[model samples]
Target: MSDELPDSIHLVLVERLPNHIAVVTLNRPEVRNAINPAITSELGHVVQALNADDVWVIVLTGAGDKAFCAGADLTTVGSGQLDDLWTDDAGFAGFVFAKRTKPWIAAVNGAALAGGLEMALACDMIVADERSTFGLPEVRVGLVAIAGGAFRLPRVIPPAIAFEMIATGQSIGAQRAFSLGLVNSVAPAGDSVTIALELATRIAGNAPIPVRESLAIARRTSDLTESELVRMSDEAWSRLSKTEDFAEGPRAFLEKRSPIWLGR
Candidate 1:
């Protein structure tokens, strides 16, 4: 893959792994995978390119085992360059509020706090290691989770627990997160990426168009009402009916053959 930004090759690493999966790894392990300006710009461009490519799944993780992300770089924040950590379209960390049609899985290797947790929450699903932790610790620093953690956490997990974490700036363990329905699965330490890739491969084997459409609607579950969701589902069906893979799915099933999705 071409590096959009010159220094991006050193900050963020983008790899096209097997099974049509593209893994975006935060490469600033020296800083515990903290988000800097270059990381924001590079990740935004990378995500945009992946969306236009033929890839089926995108997995995000950190390079080292110490942390998935430590949130914004304190050095940048202290240098008055905090604005660089955001894009006009993608928002904080080039992801929290970005519009993505494909399925994204966050493979949390370690602690995902503040903006890091917000990024995980932005993904369609999360695969965290048993040693990984999640929380919003901005309040402890006299700041707030402007990256959407304060609000998104309440919706992803229980609001009561969300408030406790948000206010206390304390993190929860992987097992507790799984028990609270915060993460899809918790693997053994250092196995989050492997498990997430397997899950992504399973999703990639199916039709891609419906999967993207389904993700689009499901992301809005908290924003839409029952009637609005019905309308959105109808719209998705209408859109899917025009795609070649939609019809191929049924034809292949009746013919007792595996469906070959054209990914239209």
Candidate 2:
């Protein structure tokens, strides 16, 4: 039965790069990197594995230049295996809701619509090719972007713009997305991953604990009240204070030298 499993099980590739960065590529480019059951399960497993590994940052992208992901492979989702399109931990693509501590960067090379956009939204940052486009076009096909797009987009960008995209099934260009603060940077064609790697390197150079702490707190800024945020920040500071990196940060500054992070 294991051998009989669909090749989609291996359709996700993981590459550990320098500077403690891991690249997870969706390999089903022939179908525009659509997520099937195997992809969902495999990606979830990969994300979990990376979370426990020494990886400081993770980059997600698709195999081809045509798409980051087209969302669920309806061919499979429409079958009796709808449940298979999800994992117990992450709802879709094994990523949109997965628990993770490390920063994730979405390298969007082309179209990132529907579930594709949801996956990108889950990332801490986005690096998109200038030629790429983004949208939650599920409405075009009688579906709703329930995989996080319907809500996450509005939080990331203007609510009116996000609502229009959702209701009309339209996509915005990369420049517009950048101006709307949806993308951190726009890269040249096929350079989304390269740009992402550069950003990851910069992040990796920082103290891992503080970086993670800062990102976690920043992400909660929208959901938490001001008082709650202050308390959370204080709590995070207390936890970070115990890490070796925390002490090294100040000591290194005093010594005018770079600090080596222990990631504790």
Candidate 3:
């Protein structure tokens, strides 16, 4: 639970948990935790490790209280490192541009603008600190929100509001982001990562099979046609029916006991 990080890696930190929750920290406080090519590579490794069945949920955060990520590292970007910014696994600037089956939660500590906001959008949930601010400021810098923000923002919030935020490059407060359904929860500054970790732990306590399948269903359902949705629902129901947790739920329900989910 300490805020201290290792002396190396320059960008990311990974801490394992008891119930399969992994906390991935963006470690670059001196530069407000900017996302550079090195950081993206480190993040790719951390994310790959979290994709294992032994790790259910991953909470993404920053090293210090100043910022989750101030955005792309302009210094690095200008130095010609932007071309190879993403990881080799088609992960955009880390995991922002890739879709992994496992669930991820963004724990925004402070400013999360441009590519940083895009990173949060890639996650399944967002837990932001009260001092945190979000913006897609690419337009202001003569670029565009190419990293999922252009596609995901409108889907998450009202299109007009999403448009305003993206086009205007205006920052939204953490509470305001929550009101607009952009963030799951807003906590006091410095507590965002802790809250995300607790939530991740709760989710990790569930059966692994169902947790992943359920997340898949929810994420895919948003883009599914009526026919496809029905098919997916049936498939999920059938798959869960074969799981040991499926029977345990009902048995424990009748016996008034806490079901022990083996994550089969």
Candidate 4:
């Protein structure tokens, strides 16, 4: 990891970790880390840079302990600045619809509502603090969660529960989210980012190529038939088997030592 800002990033804090993990914090605690055009644009740049860099895992969180994100900045929306809220390539928050290939872990420190929840739904896994809350209250304002929340939520959790959350505009606690499999884990209040970093460290220790390929297959085959998914998996495995890390795994096992992954 280098000591420089990936790009001239301001709205989002980008920290490259020693273990090939990047911690990206939405830096708008003044507004509960609300999503604005500046944050979205900078985040999109950061994500694009990280994707091309050596970073293998990404941990996304908000700046302060108050809230991971209160959702889109209502002030901007109310002012009819909706057009600036989303980017051409990256959708809302520069994440919801981005072509992210690396594994992303959402560290929900506090309330993640509306677009905030949608951003979390876009991630590969979510780690929430005990005090954190998740919701899609867009319907309360006569709006819909068109930021991938309506579609992804149902696929991740039960349809009934998803519908209930969307229809009623009610938020669920972290523990409840964990129970419904929406969150991978629930840490103590204010410790969501730490737990997420630990999880990212574990994932960063693996062979990057295989880990990325596996994540790609899992994400891409979600709506495919069993046979189609199998075919995709077979193709992924065929590509993975040729990597140097693939041979190193067994060789290291035979040598009775931890494998040294070159990520080739």
Compose the digit string of candidate 2's lDDT tens values, residues 189-262: 98999999999999999989889889989989888999999999999999988877778988999999888788
Top candidate, metric TM-score: 1
> What is the C-alpha lDDT profile of model 3 across 1-264, one tens digit per residue?
132333235567777777767778888899988888888877766665556436678888888888888878888778887766676554567688665768899999999988888898888999999999999998888887877888899999999999999889999999999999999999987899889988888887777678888888788766899798878878988999988888997898899987787876
Clashing pairs in 2: none
Computed on alpha carbons, the lDDT of every model, listed in order, comes to: 0.90, 0.89, 0.82, 0.89
- Worst lDDT window (10 residues) for model 3? 1-10
lDDT, model 2: 0.89
Candidate 3: regions farther than 4 A off: 1-10
Kindly list the per-residue Cα lDDT of model 4 for residues 1-264, writing each as its tens digit.
232346336789888879888899999998999998889878877877788888899999999988899889999999998778898777897788999879999999999999999999999999999999999999999888989999999998999999999999999999999999999999998899899999999998888998998898789767788898889889989998888888998999999999998888
TM-scores of the models, in the order given: 0.95, 0.94, 0.91, 0.95
The per-residue C-alpha lDDT of model 1 at residue 26 equals 90
Expressed as tens digits, the lDDT of each residue in 27-130 for candidate 1 is 98888899999899878888777777778898999989989999999889889998999999989988899888799999999999889999999999999999
Collision count for each candidate, in order:
0, 0, 0, 0
What's the alpha carbon RMSD for model 3? Answer: 3.9
